[model samples]
Each structure stands twice: as C-alpha cells, then as structure tokens.
Target: MKRSTLYKDELIVQIMGMTDKLQRRFQSEGVDEERSWMLQQTDNPAVISFLKRATMMMLHVIDAIVALEPVNGIRIASHLGIPRGSVSKITRKLVQEHVIQMEYLPDNKKKIMFRTTSLGKEVSKVHLALHRHVNMNVHALLNRYTPEQLAFLAQVQSDILNTSLVKEDLASIKDDPPPAAENPPEAMDMRQAAQEDPIRDLLDMLHQLDSANLSKAKDLLQVVFFAGHNG
Candidate 1:
C-alpha cells in the first residue's frame, strides 16, 4: 500500500481505539452522574430544548458582539443566517426563560440588546466542561501513539470534518424524500414496520442517511479518472 494510505488506516484505528477507551473510562469513573445527566436530558424535553436554545443564544451573542458591535434580535438572526421571526421566537423564549437579559437602547424604544445572565453563564460552563472533558479523555488515550501518528490522526480527522460539512451542504439542496417503489414487498414490509415502530424507523433512516453521507464523502475525496483523458 502507499505510505499515505497506510498512515490513514493507522490513524483510523487509533481514533477507534481512543473512542473505545473513553467510553470505558466514562462507564468506570462517572457512570452514575453520566447516567443521571443523560436521563435528565432524555426525560425532559424542556431541559433538552433549553440546552439547544442556550447554545444558539451563546453563539448569537458572541457573533453579534464581535461583528455588529451591539446586537439585537434582528442582527443576531442576520449573523446566524436564520429568519428574524425565528430569532424573535428564540430570544423571546430565552428572555422569558431567564437565560438572557434584554436591554433597550436609550435613543430608540424599539431597538434592543442582549446579554447573558448568570444562569446562562453557568450553563455555558457546563457546555464547555463537557467539550473539554470529552476531548481530554480522548486525547489522553491517543497519547500512546507517537507524535507522527498523532499528527497523521489529526490530519485525517480534519479531512473527515471537512468532508462531513460538504455532505451536509450538498444534502441541503433536497426538497423532498425520495419516492419508494410502489407495490414492492420490501417496501410494504418496511412501511408496516415503520408504522408499528416509528422511533426505530426514524433511527434506521438516520443510520442510512449517515452511511450515504459517508459514502458520498469517500467518493468525493478519492481521485480517479481516465489517465489520458483527464491528465
């Protein structure tokens, strides 16, 4: 095999191993707390949605402050490439939820600005902690590899992340689901099964989409053409 091809395979193995080790360590060290947190999010739709809203709010706040100087809902939505109505919905909900505080500009009654609350900051800390802990755990496991191996793994991960974005960007062009084959037995069975167990069907659809995305990504990254024609 080519040197680069071999190196990529080694990196994939290291990443898989690192992931396995982190999962095991989590189970061993903080299983109870982890389980509790997972259950809390899983059981409470409000809490889960709050986390999602909090993250969007934090990013909007950061981006608005950086780009627009002083940001209101309109500016936040513009920066995020979302609709103003949606931004208003999220901001109003966040304000009512007390995760953010709004301030009106003195010159204009209609103009408003936002700042994170203490509660919001606390949630941000938890979000950051989760990111750091997971990354550190994975990196610690990866440290067994040599510096060269680590560099190769990092490059491979970077490529994968980029390809994932490409896949998502391409997927966004779709307006509707693909049509199923009519009167097919496999389709009938799948339809019946999906009707019986919607959640499982949804999961299987996601898995299939994920596989397609990765397959498309692999095809995108591979270099192949008729030798004389392209060259």
Candidate 2:
C-alpha cells in the first residue's frame, strides 16, 4: 500500500477507537446533566434517532424563526433540501416533545405555521454550541498549517470522494422504519460511496461545516497527511 493510504487506514482505526471511548463515556457519565437528560430519552430509541436526524433541520428551522417570520413544513423541507413528508414527520415529533409549536394566520386557519418554543430555541442553542466547539477546535489546528498544506488536504479529500455523491435509499424508508430515522439524508446518500470507495463517511459530513471551519479543516487535514508522510 502507498504510505499515505496506509497511514489513512491506521488513522481510521484510531478514530473508531476514539469514537468507541466517547460512546462508553456517554453511556457511563451520568453526572453531566445535559448528557444525562439525553441519555434518559434514549429509553424510547425513537427520540434519540429523531434528534440525531433532525438536528441540522432544527438548527435551520430555529434560525428561520428567529431571523425571519414563522415557517411551515414546506418552507422547512425546502430550506433543508429534504422531503416535505420528512418535515411533516419531524415537526409532528417536535410538537409532541414541546420543542416546536404550530399556529395559524388569522385569515388562513387552514394554513399551519411553525415556530420554535422556548425549549426548542434552547436546544438549538445547545446544538449551535456543539457546532462552534468543532469550528473553534479546527481553527486552532489551522493556526499550525501553511496555505499549501491546507490546499493539499482539501484536494486529497476531494479526490477521495470525487467519483460520486450518495444515492438516497428511499426504499428503506418503507421497509425499515426505525433504523431509517437514525441516518440523515447526507448519510443515506454517502454511505454506499464511503463503503465502496474505502474512504471515511466523515468526509460526507464535512459539507455541514461553515465556510471558515471548512477552510480550517483543509489545513488540519493537510497537517495530518504530511505529518504521516514525514513520520
């Protein structure tokens, strides 16, 4: 195997091990109130799946509610590039959780409008904080890289995933309901690509990074790639 490719393989194993540790920590650490609450919700499994799948959608929905006016299911689906049917299902669950609330305009009683409740807004803020945590961490890493290294990292990533994007398995939605809820749309699309290509599914998630963090990610990746070469 090429040295860089071999290093990437080892890196994937290390990351998987780190993820295993995080999973164990999350399971055992009942002291953290926030994580504790989320853990408690895992009893149903549906709640956990819903939150994981809808987090990005919720973030955008909350932003729309705060920055613009109230939005409806279609608006949310359109904004997130998912199916309206998905928006409907997730909004119903969010309403059940008392996270989002539905209302109607005075003249149009039939028209349902969606808005984030106080609880929903708080959850969105929490998610935003998690997003910022990664963003800041990557930026910190970028401080150590040169521009060429950053560019190379970006190029390598693009080259790796260059062949095709994910193809959604919509059929699974009908056949297997619960498991489908855990995979986000991006995940559904890129899963086969990652598996068949022998690349990381994480590269698919890189699209979620904000522009600044994405730039940082390139630099950080470059550092990892080159450091492997040197070592």
Candidate 3:
C-alpha cells in the first residue's frame, strides 16, 4: 500500500489522542447544560446568510424534501426523526413560502404527498452549493493522502464508535420532566417555548426516546450535539 502523508507512527498517536479527547468530551454533563453561543446568535452570516434567518432545523427539512419528493409528511417526519406534528408545522411554512406543494394521489384521494416547487428547487440549489463549498474545503486537507490511506482513515474513524450506552444512558433518564416554566406564568405557544427554553424542551423529548430508536433520534437531533459541543 502507498504510505500516507501522515506517517504511521504519527497516525497512531493522533488516533489515540482522538479517542481520549472523545471520551472526555462525552463524559461531561456540564457541557450539555450550557447554552450554545451559536444558537443564541441568530444574526451570524458565517454559514448560509439566507438560511441563517430561520431555524437551522428547517434547512434539514427543506433538503430532505428536495431529495425525497413525492414523499408525504409522515415519511418526512420519519426521515428527520421529529414529531409528525412538528413536521406538519414546518411543511405548512414551506407551503406558505411556496417552497413546496402538497399533492394527493388521484386514485386514493386521501393519500397526501409533498413536492418541491420551482422556488423550492432554487432554494435547494443554494443549500446544496453551501454544502459543496464546505466539503471541497475540508477535502483539501485529505488531498495529500493516497486513496488507500484515505480508505484506511475512514475505516479507523468508523471503528472508534462507542455508542453502546446510548440506550442505557437514555433509559436512565426520567420521563417527561416538566420544563422550568419558571419564567413564564402566561401560556406561551410551542414555538415561543422552544426559543425561550431550549434545554427543557430537549429533555422532554429525550424522555420519550428509547434504546431501539435513540441512535436514529440522535442522528436527526445533531443540533443537540452541536449545542453541547459549542457550549
């Protein structure tokens, strides 16, 4: 095999360092309790300027709809691992913005589907361009590695997972613990509640997850991980 630009000894040392770093990062509960600076700063345009105006989760829904169109709300909810009701609300906003359209099967009459409109396609193109720009920049760092070395690096990264306790860890948590709700005596809607008290809402959701689906749930709730990491 062609050697990597990173020498084998250096590669091994870095991998060991990576494992230790991962363990320390995951073991800290204080990390999860802290608010994320990025989430708090809604006006930052370092990423996608247009996309930054709305909730970050909306982009995931928009991108998925483009890729899996002629799909319905239920499938979108499954794809994103969000509640069906939440997907319904997001899709409604997309429809209002002319980003997507709802269609029904002529034969079935009741079967609903979602498809991206022309405007939605334009938005998707911009979204995809942002991802491509970032990927190319990141891949520049890997260009010096031979194809074989890149493959080995991918394998090593995949082999380092330690998710066995995810379910055990999830199971140990209490069910549907009430949010602090301390500040708001008046009844605020779900959207306001989410924006005002993100952490409690997250715990309420985690209380509903289980070992069987926690991984998929986490895959979709990556913003949670980002919040923890950024905190």
As for candidate 2, its clashing pairs are 166-189
The whole-model lDDT of each prediction reads 0.61, 0.65, 0.66
Per-residue lDDT tens digits for candidate 2, residues 1-231, read 689868977997997798788788655552244443443444445445445545455556666554444987787777777888877877787788777888999999999998887767666665555557657877999879855455545654564455333565543544232322233456555643444642455766787899999999999998987777876
lDDT tens readout by residue for model 1, 1-231: 789868977996998899889888766655545434533434345445556444434534543434454578777887888888877777677678776778888989888888766655555545545557668888899988855455445655565565665446754654353333234455456555545777786566557667678676556545453444555
- Stretches off by above 4 angstroms in model 1 are 1-70, 74-86, 161-231
lDDT (Cα, tens digit) per residue for candidate 3, span 70-189: 999899999989999999898888787777899999898898899988766766666566567557867898998755455545654553343354444644654453333222233234
Residue 162 deviation, candidate 3, in Å?
4.7
Global local distance difference test of model 2:
0.65
Query: Which candidate leads the pack in TM-score?
Result: 2
Angstrom error of the Cα, residue 101, model 1: value is 1.9
Clashing pairs in 1: none
- TM-score of every prediction relative to native: 0.39, 0.47, 0.44
